[model samples]
Target: MESAATDNTIWYVLVVLGLIYLIVLYRNKRATRRRKSRRFMEGKRMHDRDN
Candidate 1:
């Protein structure tokens, strides 16, 4: 019984950790996309300013 309980706890912890990792990964991808978009907009602004 104790072993089963321990196994359940480990599985739960692993699932939670996996979710947290996925969340972080998704946030990082979103942040990078935003940064790229900002950079593109800034470039456009500078191009317009030059013209």
Candidate 2:
């Protein structure tokens, strides 16, 4: 019974760790994509004004 409880605790810890890893990975990817596109966005802004 104690082993079962320990196993459940480890599983919960693993799940939480995995979720945090995924969240960080997703944010990093989004940031990289934004960084990659920043130049294009800047260029667009420069040309967007017909004034």
**Highest TM-score: which candidate?**
1
Q: After superposition, how far is residue 41 of candidate 1 from its true place, in Å?
A: 0.3
Q: What is the C-alpha lDDT of each candidate?
A: 1.00, 0.94
lDDT score for candidate 2 against the true structure: 0.94
TM-score of each candidate structure, all chains considered together: 0.96, 0.75
Per residue, candidate 1 scores C-alpha lDDT tens digits across 1-51 of 899999999999999999999999999999999999999999999999999
Over the stretch 4-33, how does candidate 2's per-residue lDDT look in tens digits?
999999999999999999999999999999
Task: Please give the distance, in angstroms, between residue 25's alpha carbon in candidate 1 and its true position after superposition.
Answer: 0.5
**For this target, which candidate reaches the highest lDDT against the unseen true structure?**
1
Report the Cα RMSD per candidate: 0.5, 3.5
What shift in Å separates residue 50 of candidate 1 from its native position after superposition? Answer: 0.8
